[model samples]
Target: MKRRAWIVWLPPVLSGAFLIALWYAGRAATGLQSWILPTPGEIFQAAWNEHATLLRAAGGTAVGALGGFLVAALAGLAIALVLGGARWLRTGLYPWLLVVQMTPVIVVAPIIVLWAGPGLPGIITVTFLISFFPIVVNTTQGLLSAEAPMVDLFRMYGATRWQELQLLRLPSAMPYFLAGLRIAATLAPIGAIFGEYLVGNASGGTGGLGFLVYVYNTQIKIPALFATALTSCLLGFIFVAAVSWLNWALLHHWHDSFERHDR
Candidate 1:
């Protein structure tokens, strides 16, 4: 158990240490100005000094990302269900879905802001666009991946379409949906930040971490900028970790997806 724990924890610890060392070394070697590249200490101090503002900005970003993730998950699941249930619809719509996914969000953000009037709605729309495709594709694949024999058994048992879906298909899709959700959670923040970058504080306010990042950048506050970025990274890590825990909790019992190979 200790070895297992070490294997899981060591790499990240080492990597973080290495990064800190490198940052310190580079600062000492190059004698870079604080604005060019502040030391980790400077960044930490900035973070401590601006804790309240940073926390509020981080909270806004987190909320936007979470809200967008929920919206994407629901919409993706609904679309997947429609496509999975109707072969003709799947055949016709699948290609278009790919096109939607392929389209860059940068190109789409302005259009969304135009329609949504540049605020939380626009940010949420950008987040939704950025994170929507994976869930749709994964859930559709999962729903369709039901074992043939199981499906046949259901049919033979005179199971209704809804019954087949509820009993077999949806459960089979859970792992895939969860996997997509993990990916979506990570991407959601990026989408929210990008939206803020493009739209500014469109809600007639200072907005989220993205806006803070912009403000710090333009004002040449490198330590604060790094601190803001680190905060964003921490947020992403938390969101991903939360989803991973949920995945393990939900799937570890029956699903082979979470089965312990060592066991």
Candidate 2:
């Protein structure tokens, strides 16, 4: 297990090292100034200097993303439940859902920010909008994808729709639901940042990463800009890692995907 864990981590570690080396080499080769492009060392220094501000901003973004993700998860599941129940609902509403999703986030964000008053509420709403569609799609498919034999057996036993859903369909859908969450996890932080960029003005120290990105770029703080960008990537990575852990915890024992490793 230790060996496997180490092996799993090795590639990324090496890749990161290689990238750092390349960053150095590229800067040396091009003779670019720090203002135009900062070195990794310079970025690290800026991040350390701005650690308090960055940490606070990241916390605010985290709150917004988590709040939005929770709302999206609950609402998405409820919608999926309704849509999965009847073919008519699926046919009528699903197409509309597609249309809503096809609409760009950029187009809708400003409108939401205006209504929600450029605050945490607005940020959460934007995040929810960005992360909503996949969960509904996946959960609806999972509900409908329950094994026919199991569904028939429940029907034969005179089970109600709710009972069947609770006993068989939801359990079947768990994997799919988690899959959708995994995708959302990657996206929620981005939405939060975007919201911040547009309307996250409730700043005590740091408004949010997106706002900081704007600040750093306009001020020509290249190293801090890179640091902020790296922080955003780390936040997304943490969210993804959390979802992956959830998947393993929920599916490791019974899911065929993991069962092979037991052998």
Candidate 3:
């Protein structure tokens, strides 16, 4: 168990250490001004100094991301199910979904902000738009990917459409849905932060990490900007980790995709 744990953790630990070392070495060698490229230590110090404010901002961003993720997950699943069940619907709507996916979030975000107004709603909308595509596509594929033999068996057994969907399609799609969720976990924060950049509290008193990033950048507080950006990355890491944990908990026992095999 201990060996396995070490094997799992060692790569990330080493990578982090190596990156930090290189960062330190590059800054030491360059003798750059803090404003141009703040050293990692300076960024860390800035984060530490403004820990309270940063934490609050992180919390706000997290809330928006989490809310958007939940909404996206539910809506994506429903859309996938509908599209997967109906050939006509799939043909009609799937192309439009593709168009939406291709449309840049930068283009849509401002429109959302204009229509929804500045704050959490616009942020959540952006987050949902940015993160929901993978879920829909993956889930639709999964739902349709059920083995023909198995589907024939179910039909032969007199299974109703709803029964087949509930018992076979949903179970088959679990891994794909979770995989999409993992991708969305990283994306949700990006959407939230981007939205905040556009529509966050203009007063800057209470907003998300996105707002902090904007404020720090405009003020030319390089270390603080780096710190805020780091915080956003950390949030994405945490979200991905949580999704991975959930995936393991839910799928490890039954799903071949998640099953561990000792070499």
Candidate 4:
């Protein structure tokens, strides 16, 4: 298991290291000032120096992001199940779902913030809005993707719609649902950060990372700005890694995608 985990991680680690080295080398070759383009080293230094502030901001952001993600995951799954179970409702409302997804988040975020109020509620609402659509889309596709022959066999056995859905469709859709979740997990932090930038209030002496980004940028703390950016990336990576782990845990035993890995 440890060996397999290393195999999973080694390529990305190597690639990221190479990229960082190249970024540093390129900046050195360009003769740019730190204010213009901070190197990875400088960014690390700044992150370490401002660790207290960064950690505080990260904690605040994490709460909002996780809060929103949990809501989206539950609501998205429930809504998808409802839509999938009813053909008439799906036919009538599916387009509307698409329209909602099509609407730019930036356009609606302020309105959501205004309605939900600032701080945690507003943050969670923004995150849920950003992360909800993909779950519905992917899960719907999966529910619809069940094999025709198998479904007919179930029907021949006089299986009820609920029985067919519970036994056949839901199991088949697990991979797709997890795929959507992984995608949404990546977006959760961005939603949280954006929410913070727009309407976040300070909690425990620190604003969210989005607010910190603005602060650092306006203060012309270039290294700190870069550090904040790196911190956001780190947060995103954690979300993704967690979902990936969940995906592996659920699917590895039976799914074709992870079959080889199981051995």
TM-score of every candidate: 0.94, 0.94, 0.93, 0.89
lDDT of 1 at 184: 94
Candidate 1 differs from the real structure by a C-alpha RMSD in angstroms, to one decimal, of 1.7
When 1 and 3 are scored with TM-score, the better candidate is: 1
Candidate 3: C-alpha lDDT: 0.89
Candidate 2's TM-score: 0.94
Q: Would you give me the overall lDDT of model 1?
A: 0.88
Candidate 3 local lDDT, 1-263, one digit each (tens): 65578888899999999999998899889998889988888999999998998999999999999989998999999999998987999999999999999998887766887887668888888889999999999999999989999999999999999999999999999999999999999999998898788667643434699888877878989899899989999999999999999999999888877556663
Whichever of 1 and 4 has more TM-score, that candidate is 1
Model 2 clashing-pair count: 0
Candidate 1 lDDT over 1-263, as tens digits, reads 65578888899999999999999999999998988889999999999998898999988888878878889999999999998988999999999998988998788777887897686888888889899999998999999999999999999999999999999999999999998999998999888887777774756544689999888888988899999998989989988998999999999899976667666
Please report how far candidate 3 places residue 197 from its true position, in Å.
0.5
Q: In candidate 2, what are the lDDT values of residues 1-263, reduced to their tens digit?
A: 65578788889999999999999999999999998889999999999999998998898889988988999999999999999989999999998999888998788767886777677888888898899889999999999898889989999999998899899999999999999999999999999998888777644323789888888878988899999998999999999999999999999889987866445
Per candidate, the number of residue pairs that clash is 0, 0, 0, 0
lDDT of 4 by residue, 200-244 (tens): 753322288988987887799999988988899999999999999
Q: Give RMSD (Å) of candidate 3 vs. truth.
A: 1.9
Error of 1 at 230 (Å): 0.5
Alpha-carbon deviation at 78 in model 3, angstroms: 1.0
